[model samples]
Target: MATEKLRQANTGIRSFWWWLQCIVSLLLTALLVMDRAEWIDVPGLQRLEWQAYDWRVRSTLDGQSDSSLAIIDIDERSLFEIGQWPWPRTTVAALIESLFTTYDADLLGVDIVFAEPEASHWQRHWENLVEEYPSLASLPPPTDGDQVLANTLSNYPVVLGYYFQSSVQAGDPPVIGQLPEQAHLTTDSLLSLPEPQRYTANLAILQNGALSAGFFDNPLVDADGVFRRVPMLQRWQGELYPGLPLAMLLALLGQPQIDPVIGEGSGVDQLEALDVGGFQIPVDADGSALVPWYGPRGHFEYISAADILEGRIEPGSLKGKILILGASAPGLMDLRSTPVGAVYPGPEINLGLLAGMLHQSFKAQPPWIQGFDLVNLCALGLIIVVIFPRLNAPLLMAVSGTLLLAAVGGNVWAWHQGWVLPVAGLVVLLLAQTLWHLSMNLLRETQQKRWVAEWFGQYVPPQLVKSMVESGESFGLEGEERELTVLFSDVRDFTAFSELLSPSELTRVMNRLLTPLTGAIHQHKGTIDKYMGDAVMAFWGAPLRDMKHADHAIEASFEMLAALERINREFVAEGKPTLAMGVGLNSGPMSVGNMGSGFRMAYTVMGDNVNLGSRLEGLTKVYGVSLIVSEATAKQAPDWCYRRLDQVRVKGRRAPLWILEPLGRWSTLSQERCTWHAAFETALDHYQAANFESAAQAFKELGEEDLTTQIYLARSEYFLKTPPPQNWDGVWMHTDK
Candidate 1:
């Protein structure tokens, strides 16, 4: 019996490893569920999602601007030539007249707010002159510039700009301009939304003259300061004001009525989209829409305000096009961060939004998308949990990489089709799962190798054990039939040797002898089965498969003899008793595996062939040989030299079996040994034929000191004197084991 304890030790480690995998899978699943339920919103994950979103927006842009929109920039040159900002209202009136009458622009929207009327220097001068003269007050106040600008606004289709303020002050700015009658709608399912408390609007003079007005407040600037979306409409004091871009689109669409799509559940209401005429503009639950960037900054054609005022602009440049008036001079501070550029002109953002609306290219992320993300997250996590453990390393990597591509690729395609899908969470989960599995499997295999080495390394060769471990084969230790070679060895006079020494000394002797014997077996790639007192049992083609099992077994037997000789020299030097051993080798089919009761187990071999090997070791003492091999082993190792012993039926069997004494290798044997072998074979043939006198004469000629020859001679003489039976097959029957 070998060390069966090794088999029992592995059960606990394997169980623990399996449990570890389950724990990791459960943790990942929990994380996925938490994120899906919106119970945990990871800031880093959201930030990275926005970053990926920015990249998708940039890469998916059509890079083509709408030709129907134009920007009238009061640029640096306009500031230099037309005298700084807050120019005389007459100059502003002239620019508006050029856009409407001269260029015939279809619709115009201002990104600037006339919150406070310009304090005209001429008015100051006229007031001082009148105060000094006291008689020029009847001169009509030199034509108020505010009235001139207000008159110009009244005659044209211009949308004025205003801003909503969340901060409250002691005074309230006048509410300017009329909002469309259908701008704000409240449904039965909706709740009251928070509205701004304060406003910065135009003077009553400008408000009365303007056709309509909108809030220029972009409430969707992210914490990172990127302008990604604009609120389509905002509430102030229960009144709705459209954003400048939406207001311009409404004017261009002939002031179509606004309608809010409401969805209700659990007494909570949300707006899904806004319907205008036949076009449906989708929005978030908060009524914000994702900006569809056409390209980089400066996408819209800009005509200088000074160029329009001086009539130096090209004719028909603004004709039949929507015009957005804003400032681009660095001093004006109207630049903002956007997906397309970090320092984008604010007016260009409005123009891009308006263009996106006209082309119906806005991206929407409504409430249903959250359900879509949750479904995808759970599905992807399930795939990882189920398939990761079942696949090999290369195949697992391939599956992970394919999933990553599908997640990202599908998200990009959805973005191109105007559907905003959450990609960051799915992509991160795929990558994290792959890395987690990889690291855990590596750690598991490392521990498994250490376990295998601790149990079997002493019995099996290192190279063979390493091969088994790396192959990743499972070894379920139930009994199995396999062709194997078994070896059994015992000290020739072990009982006498033990009787001469104390118990401790006998153990020392056994340790010294068994150490080199074990080394020899392992060197030949055989497994040392176990040691019983002074006897050692070993086998090959077990615990691992060895095609050269028979050859290795024979080689190990020869080495055992050599090791014994070396051991004898040391014992002689120490004035200790010398030792001799007999080894028997047999090759056949046997059952090899972990076998025993619940409390004990043994990874060993058992069969009729194994018993025959033990019987052969006992017969070695009768033949005076150190090594004996059954015919099965001898036939497999043709390159080794052997002397045929005899055909004998042992105590257990009815059929007789041939045995042989293993000599040195065939290539190393001398011609003298070959001649002797031939002569001994002839004598054995004659004896089996019942020629007693001839066989005895031939045995005496060979060697009187040869124990095998003497045994055969004695057998021949005894059989001749007894008178042979009719069915004598020349097979000796041994009565003792």
Candidate 2:
């Protein structure tokens, strides 16, 4: 169990220590963020984040893509049937015509760039014959395939793709065919969108004749050559043009006026997001977006391009479905490495962006994520700084592991919410600080041990100190399992009265109450585990074994009750409030050790029995008793007189435990308590046998003033009205924590 002082820290930033940790954490976070302030990152962290992102996507995607989208694959089968890529322009035109005129596709994004016109083999051969023979000129002229494809583009809804170049040969023309001028970026606000150096677009006639077009280039590919982010828009000569997916969406959304949102209060005018009729898409300053993958290749339905031309596909089956026209054939060289697949088709990048934008599902790292990460780092750092110094080595390891696990888990959960929070800085902060504090603690412990003679005699038994000082390495704090007695005590309704007192007054009152209780535990040779507000937990066993651990623990619990009564009397005389406390004890084989992380530790016991003792303490309120113990404890210390309370399973365990309340020493037990205890057990047995009427009558005869009798009376009356099932075992399942 965690100490109470640490639990108090979780409430808020209330103390100077807590506030200092916050300031320190904030400053550290600021420095970390400063190191990663812009597009640059610290060393290999960005690539590690990429790996983390890929693993997350691969794990969560259900291998399904949006049904509204499909891919027209120019695969190997299509290449065999159509006789290699760069097929006759007429055949390409036929494919385009079939997408709209035959299948009624809602929109088509052609992922190929036609930078130059293509002449059919027959047309080239016929031209040679005409130059070689004069009579050939009289023959009917063959069709111009480029004109055929251009006319086909003009006749349908097609956004033809184009490529962009960051640099070109010195002599070559930097500009190519037509750029889309009519549907250019319409935002009145000035923005710093990426402007490439040059572009290789479609042939002028084809580009001019098409409905619209966008760059097929993925200018924002990662350093690892993986297509994780693709630019949504690009600029050249102060003109903005949407990418392929954006262009198709614009065509789908009826070409709404595009709005480029620019960040304010900053000298650099960066684009924050793009708004098309209020369908907002958060974009990076340079208009890049993380690709929302639909899983590996073939997630989206793939239709062979040859099937469309040959009429083998179902007619109108693709109607109203957005189709991306591209190739998967390795010879085409249009494949790209991606997170989901190494041999992924390039068209899927555009397809993913398109689908994600429509669904608003793409994960994003906006400007505010830096602030979120900073704040979270500050909180985590505060926890580590404030708590690490006081904990033992064993507890330091446990707490540090839990804190890091929670930080990483929360980061992943945020990713699922479509916000990307970088985990690298937080990890660095936790691990580095833990190691520094842990090392300092070990050094401090060694120095303290060497000087044990000065301060140790007053705290521990003189013999223990003498043994330790004589043989410096005589004791160790390793783990061991032994039969022991555990105790848990808490002030009843302490929160109610504690809220009524001033902070200083409450502190004094808690000290007055806790000091004596701790003394009583020590008087009976018990080890103090830790203090948690008004509660005190202690145990008896090794660190100096006592064969009568259960007897000592029970005697200590009685002594604590006597001490509390004296404090209450003094408070009542002084016109101050008084509080009652309850304690629970359990005796069994429990694992005890120096429990904590490397920073600090405390000798504490832990096991199912220890937990049961704590659970029994909580049940004190339910049973309205001051002392309770498991049957194991009552059995071990047979000198105590106990009233059997209930037989039931606690929250975590599967088996049942017999819970009982200790009255007093057997020698001091009154005849009245003995008679009452006998009467209650008989009634409880009858109730367990389903004889509710007899049990209720017997419990009523025992009187309602007694809280224990009241509990059974209430239960028996209820069961008398509604009989239990025949197979009921009469064990109550206590589910409350």
lDDT of 2: 0.80
What does candidate 1's lDDT look like per residue over 1-737, in tens digits? 24345445566776686677657866776686677678986657777888998998888777787788899999999999999888888888888988999888988898888766665567789889999998897767776777888999999989878777655667655554334332644442342333666667776688678777777777568878999877888776566678888887777777777777776754656777777665667788767778878888777898888888888977777779989899989899999988778899988888887887788888887567777888898888888888886555667799999999999989888877778888888987887788888776777778777866765676677876876676666654668899999999999888987898898988898889888998899888898788988899999987778888989998888888899999999989988888889999999999987777776666788999999889999999989988889999988888888888998888888989888997778899999998998899999889888887889889989988889999988887887789588788888787777
Candidate 2 residue-wise lDDT, 1-737, digit = tens: 34334324323322443355445545655556665565445677678778877887787786767888999999999999988878888899999889888899988999998877675556788889999997989888778888999899988888889978766777878677778754546673555556678888888888877878988887678899998887777777766788899888888888887888776543556667788766777787667788888788888889999999999988888888999999999999999998899999988878988888898887877666666776776677677667876665668788988889988898889878887778877787777777766675566555445445343333334454444533423233556899999999999889998888999998898888888998898778777777888888888875566779999999999999999999999999988788899999999999986678757666678998889899999888888899989999989889988888988888999998889988888799889888888898899898888888899999999987889788888888888788788898888889875
Q: Which stretches of candidate 2 lie over 4 Å from their true place?
A: 1-31, 38-41, 120-125, 131-135, 169-173, 182-190, 262-270, 442-737
Name the best candidate (by lDDT): 1
Whole-model lDDT values for every prediction: 0.81, 0.80
Error of 2 at 112 (Å): 0.2
Instruction: Report residue 520 deviation for candidate 2 (angstroms).
Output: 22
Q: How many clashes does the backbone of model 2 have? A: 14
Instruction: Please give the distance, in angstroms, between residue 277's alpha carbon in candidate 2 and its true position after superposition.
Output: 3.0
Residue 484 CA displacement from its true place in model 2, Å: 22
Candidate 1 lDDT trough over 10 residues, lowest sum? 185-194
Query: In candidate 1, which residue ranges exceed 4 Å CA deviation?
Result: 1-9, 119-125, 132-140, 167-194, 261-270, 387-398, 461-589, 593-604, 609-737
